[model samples]
Target: MKKHNFSAGPSILPQEVFEKSAQAILDFNGSGLSILEISHRSKDFVAVMDEARALVLELMGLTGKGYHAIFLGGGASLEFARVPYNLLKEGGKAAYLDTGTWAAAAIKEAKFFGQTEVIASSKADNYSYIPKGYTIPADADYFHYTSNNTIFGTQMQQFPDTDVPLVCDMSSDIFSRQLDFSKFGIIYAGAQKNMGPAGATLLVIKEELLGKTGRAIPSMLDYKQHIDKESMYNTPPVFAVYTSYLTLQWLKNNGGIAAAEAKNNAKAELLYNEIDRNPLFVGTAKTEDRSKMNVCFLLKDEAHTEQFDKLWKAAGISGLPGHRSVGGYRASIYNAMPIESVQVLVDAMQELEKSIQ
Candidate 1:
């Protein structure tokens, strides 16, 4: 039986990527050494690093003139602090959109490093809708936001135009859809969810955005330092980067971002329509702000949670449980998740609803 995975991060990776990557580990391109055993400083591994970084730029539609793509450690949590440390300067205020857990955490980290303000939020509707129509301060250093709220299931469908730099934490929805990269000064996403594996994070930053901060930064904490070193100042996660390389290759060969976007749209629509059409299930996020990646829903009778959990498990499905904060179910359909898996969940819901009725 093929078990379907709906767990959010450290989530699904393409079967093809895994197959090629496993072979590479044994003997990479006739090098006769395990990918993990090779030195990251070697020329063989350097090509992998180079291609992985390059593919990110190509995937995002960058022309290769304005931005630098980097793979770094520490997940997106490090970026929460690193973003403000690099972009937020003295006497320079930054604007943030507070949507849910990740956004709130990013805001808190930024406050300790510099002057920060919350320009918009969805706390009023209990975070079901995206906040709108707020003016970004002209003096702001940069405006920061999370593209998709994984736990809450709300995505910023369209970004607000701002004059200052726009930075996004795209940890949950990276590569799941096509985005306008020119609109953002900096974009970062942890790779565990849609890209490849854990222990790696991707960052794309415009060249002009760095070096404005007057404060001194530690060698490792500085974005410019990593960029200057070409993400090689220290040894990188070799195995993770190799797997990501295979995944990017798979993406390129199987139709790049456009193909992924269409498939993601179809999968999300199938489940969201099911949620809306069913009387027993209720969607947490509002209509306009629903996420194309994470589809969260709950049963009408919260008391039947135990029985519902058993039914899904017996069906050989897993990871449909929601974050404790959301208190229901979240089916994270990332890049590698087959639409068939979604159809299975949809069928399960129909069966569960009928049985309950």
Candidate 2:
């Protein structure tokens, strides 16, 4: 049975990407050296890094717009601190929207760097809905938010437009949709989710936004240093960056972000429609805020949980379990997940409902 992958992070990637990466591991570009053993300073690997950075800018519509893309060794969690370290100035206040777990974590890290204020939050409701109608402080040095909440299954439908510099951690939803990249001063994402395997983080920073923080940033955490060195200031994550490059190539071949969003919406709809229709199931997030990438749901009747679990398992499903903190089910329908796999999941849900009825 072919397994349907729905893992949250280090998730599914295009089959073609996997095949190409495997071949490159053995002998990269006919150079007779494994991608693993290849030198980071090599001309061949430099080409890969350059292409990956260029592709990220192109896909986000930031090409030649004073935006520099860099891949780093740390994940998005590290970026939570790095963002404030490089942007939140001393004695200046930073505003954040607390939509879910990651957003809360970002707020926690920002406090260490400066005066951090949570302008809005939906944690009171277990983060089922995205907060709205809250005022962002005009005097804030910058505003930070997570574009998608993987654990809570909520995504901000639209970004807040504020004079304060906008920074985002798009770890779970980057490249999953089309966006006006010009609106954000900075955007960072972990490559594991929609981009590629774990190990590298993608950062798209506006050139003019650096040096305003007035703090002595560590070498690795400084965006200007990474940009000046062309993402080669230190030994980069070679394997992860290469895989991400392949994935970006795949996205470009598949018609870029717009095409991915169409498929992602379709897959989310297929499963969410079932969750709403089936009397045995119900979605976790509010209808309007439901995440297209991570769809969290639960069985309506707790007694039937085991039956539903076995139903999906028997149908070759994997990673349907929710985060441990939230005991439910989360179906992560990323860019690489096909609509057919979603239909299979929907069919399994329908079959289980029928059996119970």
For TM-score, the strongest prediction is: 2
* lDDT tens readout by residue for model 2, 77-184: 999999999988888999999998999999999889889999888988999999999998999988999999999999989888778889999999999999899999
Please identify model 2 stretches exceeding 4 Å from their true place: none
> lDDT values of the candidates?
0.89, 0.92
* Model 1, span 1-357: residue lDDT tens: 788899888898999888888898899878999998999988999999999999989988996668999989998999999999998887788999999888999999999987899999887777887888888898999999999999989998888787899999999998878878889999998888988889888899998989888889898999999999998979887888888888888888889989999999999999999999988899999989999999988999887788778777877787889899878999999989999999888888888788878
TM-scores, one per candidate: 0.97, 0.99
Candidate 1 is scored at a TM of 0.97
Q: What lDDT does model 1 reach? A: 0.89
lDDT of 2 at 243: 98
